[model samples]
Structures are given as C-alpha cells and as structure tokens.
Target: MAANNGLRYKDKVTIVTGGSKGIGLGVVQVFVKNGAKVVFCARREAEGKEVEADLNKLGIGEALFIPCDVSKEEEIKNLIEKTVAKYGRIDCLVNNAGYHPPHMPIDDFSSDDFRELLNVNLVSYFIAAKYALPYLRKVEGNIINMSSLVGQIGQFGAVTYVATKGGISAMTRALSIDEAKYNVRVNSVSPGNVWTPMWNSGAQATPNPEKTIENGANSQLIGRYGTLEESGTACLFLAADATFCTGIDLNLSGGAELNYGIKTMRGEKELPF
Candidate 1:
C-alpha cells in the first residue's frame, strides 16, 4: 500500500519519542527504511549519540538525535522545534516512551511510582501532541501511541503500569475524534510480551528468570515473545499505511490477549516445589 503521497512515505518527516532504544528505536529504524526522515529523542545522551551514528552510517535516511525527557513540556516543545527547523514539517508522531517497574500490588505501590509512570507513559504524550499537533495539522499527519496488553486485561500485580497504558488507549481514542476534523489520525499499538530491554531486565531479575519467562512464553499462541521488528512493523502500519484508520487499538500481542486469566494453578506439578 502507498504510505503518504504515493503509498509509501518517501519524504515524510516523523518524530519518535524514546528513540534511543527498544521498541521506539525499532520504529525509528522502520521509518528510516521506508524513506521517512526520522527525528528521535531520549534522555540518555550516550545511547542517543550511538543510535544517531548507527543510522547515519546506513545512509538510507537522515536521523537526528535530540536529548530529551518526554515528560517535560519545554523539552517536548524544543524537540518539535528542532525537527521542524530541519525537516520543515512533521508527518507523524510516535509516542513510544514508557516506564515499567517491577511488579507490585496496588496496596504496596508508592505515590512516587504512580507519578513516575504518569510522567513517562501518559502525560508525555499529551505534552508531545500539544507541540506536534500544529505541524501535523499542516500535513494531516498521524499519531501512534504505544500501549500494552496488560492495560486491556489487567495484570495481577502491575497496577500502575497497566493504569497508565489504559489511559493511553483512552487518550488515543479521544484524541482521534478531536483531531479528525483537521484530517489528523490518532491510534495505538498494544504490545503484549515483547523481548526488548525492558523485558530483558525483568527476566534477569525474576526468580528462576529463564523458567519464568519460558512459562510466560508458552502462554502465548505463538509460543514465543515478540521482537522489536514486530512492534516496529505495527507502528509503521499505523503511521503510514492506515490512512483511513484512527482511534483504533492494534494488538501486537501474538494472540496472547485472547488467552486471558489462565495462570498456573497452585499445587500443580509445574510448580517449582
């Protein structure tokens, strides 16, 4: 399918938040490959510079790395400013930055935890959109919010993370309706179990890490976790190809979302007793 003007976004400009690593980086790579000029930002200077260098070496598309904290309104504004200054217009915004801490029950969660998740996962999108909307309006662009499966089907102990993702889903829907008149589109991709840095960190720390993740993997119909490429492909579909689609939640959960609430029962032989 054609992406922007001629099906594929050959010269479109895109901004990807949290572009230094993980799914965000994956999205950046895909946009670059598909002929989009990508501007990505993250808090870490080293990673940003490294990724910038890597993409520059490819010589397929231009990549600009801006050091940014997505939660800060001023930084978000500056990010959009820099991108427009260089690219002249914004065609798409990928709100992909997020924070997921170790699992904790709602009662055990601290106030700081809630604030942190809101700043990164939910509020950041608001800030980014506030600044990017005008440029997007110029081109009738699109916004792709990164959501999670846990939000749709609440996890046992990840209350704060799930809440933030749930908020993103709702916000995307609301924003879509509000922005449609301007011909702009807003949508979200809900990834289930993706094997990115976040999952790696969780896996290494979990008790019997390998076995724990293995069991989690088996729960999915694919019998495996998702890759950065998989999530990136989904983002590309929403951003460039889905011209008539908006306010939709595309599940990249490998069908795991369909198999809900079925955990290993107690006293089962699978227990590590």
Candidate 2:
C-alpha cells in the first residue's frame, strides 16, 4: 500500500543520521512531510544544509541540518545533545547512516578494514543509541535501525558489510528488551536492493552496469528495485504506527527472501482490475 502523506506526526521531534541523501534522505522527507520536527546529520555540511533548506520550504515541518561523522563517538554524543537542546525532546531516532565498501572476498578483507566498517555501520548505531536513550526514555521514544536483507540471507563478496548489518539486527532485539520497561521501543527495517545513490554507485562500478542493475532488480520478487519513498514509509510505520512493536526486524525485501533460486517475471501477466 502507498504511504499516507498526511500530517500524522505533527511536531514530533526526530533525529535521522545520513539524511543528506539516499534512504536517509527519504526517511527525513517522509518524517518532515508528516509534520515532524527533524534534526538530520551527515558528514557533508553543504548537502545537509541544502536538504534542510529545501525541506523547510515545504512549510509542513521543520528541518535542521547538523554536520557529523558518525564514526566518532564524540560526534554522536554531540548530535544527541544538540538535538535535545534544540527540540527539548526526541520522539524517535532513525539510525540510517552506513557504508558499504566494494565487494570483495573475505580473504581479501583485512581485520582493520572490517573494524572500520563496523565503526561506521554498527558501532555508530550503538553510540547514537547510548546517547539518545536517556532522552528517548524521557519521551518514551522509539528507534528505527536501517538494516539489510543480507543480514539474514548471506551475500557473496560482502562479508564485512553483512557482519555489520547482522550486528544491527541483533542489537535492535537486545536493546528493545532492555528498553521495553521504559516504554521505549527499538526495531529495525531490512531492505533489499533499494534504489539509492549507493546502489547506483555500486552498479556503475561494475563492468556491465546496466546488466548488474537489471540482475539486482530481478533478484527481488518485485520486478523493480525498491524506492526511497518506500523505504522511508517503512520507517515511518515502525516509528509512528507500530505502537506495540519492539525488537522486530521488519523486512522490506519485496519478497526477495521468498522461495529459492533466481527470481524472474517470466510468463507473468497482468490481472483484470
């Protein structure tokens, strides 16, 4: 179903990481359009500011851009502090910032490389949650972690990335159990082949970019790649609508995990309306 664009979250305070582009941008846009007061951060100040300015012009919600590198613990702490100081409370936190390096075999990846990837993709989420929890507890807020379908199913040539995502899903469950007493929820969204800048970059790096993209799309039961809006809407659902949900890892995989073998649209026909 299509997401409702109405102002369902009017004035709710939210923080989203990596909100300058891709799935993060989509989450920010969805939250803002739903009448939220969002503080979004990215390493790129210019892009963050641009997103903030453009979103603010919509006149539906407020957007504040903060420059941050999530790999640093201090930066994550500061981000939470600044948001709480400005908004007085945080209703939701969306941990969406992540890095997916070029595909390579496990043997080719160094321990240091794996550690660095963990810092960016997994450790940052932990740090953000550590700092944001007190405020979230105060308001009974929720967290929506951005995970990946590969975290569940395995992916070849991406052991490091898969490890990080798997950690996120595990952490989401454990954190939710710990925070449930405070009425704060923790959950995750695992997406498959979402159409984002990172995906485009990965595709472009391949020898046959078009064929690579086509294969990626065909991997899902759906005939196309998932959209940013779809990813954003899933987060919104977890944050705003799934009141009793916690420790749940929602899959936005377009049925990619269903059945076995390669997915194809062969012999498909449209049904009568």
Candidate 3:
C-alpha cells in the first residue's frame, strides 16, 4: 500500500499490546499521529502511564494505558472488554507483546521455562485475538501479528523464541481463513535485527556488548539495525491500507533474512526445514 497525505486511521480505534516500549511504542505513536484512538497495555504501570501521558500531550490521537499481564487469560479478556467498553467498537488489534530470554540452546531450559515462554510469547496472541474477534467482526477490522525472522529461519541459540515466533506466523495464516467470512483480515509482520531497547538489553548480556552490537549492525546488508519506525510503518500499512492482503507474512528485514547468495555459493542445496 502507498502512503497518502490524508489521515489514514482517522477516528479508527486500535488496541496495542505491550505498547510501553520498543516496536510497540512506535506503533502506538504512529497510530496516534494518524488520528486513531489507541488503547494499549503493559505489565509495567509506571512506563505505561508515562507513555500514555506523553501521547496525550501530543494532542493528536487519544491513548489509554491499561496495566495488564497478557500471560493470563482473564487479563487478556478484561483488556478486550475494557477496550470495547470505552471505544464502543474495535478496529484493529496489534499483538506485539513478546520477549526472548538470553540466548540458550534447547537443553538449557526446563519444561517450566519453556511453558512460561510459550504462554507469554505465543499463547497470549491467540487469546487476545480470540477475545477481540467478535467485536472486530462487527467493525470489519483486522489483526496484525508480530512474528520474527528468527522464527522463519532458526536463530542459532534461540530455539524456544524461534518456535513461538514460527507459531505466530502459522497462526496468522490460519486465522485469516477463519476470519475471512467476517471480513476481518489477518497478517504478520516479521522483522529481522531491530535496535530496540529489548534488542540492546539482550545484546548487553553478552561479553563485550559493544562489540556484539557492532557486529550485529555490520552484519546487516543495510549496514545498520532496523529502526522501530520501519516496523511501525509496516504495521500501519497492514492495518490501514493493505486491503487486498490477508494471511501474508510481510518481512521488514534489512536483508538479514536473505543469505541465499552466500548459501548458494557454499553449495548448500537444501533448506534445513
């Protein structure tokens, strides 16, 4: 979809999970600037209120910060109920709350660790979508799922995170089909190496974090980490203008997801998957 000078989301109502920081914060800012009233939640009350106050002061679009722990079904249910209660209708749901624990191999994690990861990173998306679907159907709205390049092609030491992201991509496709009859579109945005606070913090866990981040930035074909703004734009495009698209995984990778040329040169003939 192409951008226009007009307010794309004028008067639209949106719900953004994890809107306290990173890509989620960017999405909230962009939507508010475009004239959509946003209801966003986070586990941290202080950060959420700070964001809410900042957005409200902008005097563009309205923003509400609801403190929530998305890992709980009741909380997600309450989030959706509160959203519809205030707005009276829901137009878009951006499922963006997820985290990757420090890079670790499969055997490093216990069953409980894996289960907790699954609950917060993956299951919450489904629960949020399930709760929002009925009202989304009423408005012919859409859902934007945040997947990752790590999910598509396994990230070396992030098996658990990769699995959850892959599940998101798969779920997005299935959901599109289920929601088609109701005219609600579903799609995923998969980002490669973004330089958000979450990414920076994760990188800091390594020895020589400066070197690690530098190596990551230089590894990108674009010679820089992807910005949260880029991801926000992709999401806004899917939500406001991708009218003909559904069940699609739109990649905003800075060539990080593409190593076909190097792989081909190395004579690798088959994909691992």
- Give the number of the best model, judged by TM-score: 2
The segments of candidate 3 whose C-alpha lies over 4 angstroms from its true place after superposition are: 1-5, 260-273
Predictions in order: lDDT: 0.87, 0.92, 0.89
Query: How well is each residue in 150-262 modelled by candidate 2, as lDDT tens digits?
Result: 99997867899999999999999999999999999999999999999999998898778888889889888997899999988999999989998999999999999988884
Score residue 131 of candidate 2 by CA lDDT: 92
- The candidate that wins on lDDT is 2
**RMSD vs true structure, all candidates:** 2.9, 6.2, 4.3
List TM-score per model, in order.
Answer: 0.92, 0.93, 0.93
Ranking by TM-score: 2, 3, 1
Residues 1-273 of candidate 3: C-alpha lDDT, one tens digit per residue: 525347688778999999999999999999988889999999999999999999999878899999889999999999999988898999999999999888766788888988999999999999999999999999999999999987887776677889999999999999999999999999999988888999899887887788888877866778898887787888999999899999999987888866553433245342211
Q: Candidate 1: misplaced stretches above 4 Å?
A: 1-7, 264-273
Question: Candidate 1 on 1-273: residue-level lDDT in tens?
Answer: 343444256778999999988999899888887778899999999999998899878867678899999878899899999999998999999999898878755888999979988998999999999899999998999999999988898776678988999999999999999999999999999988888888878777776887878976875788898888888889988886788899999999888877455565566543331
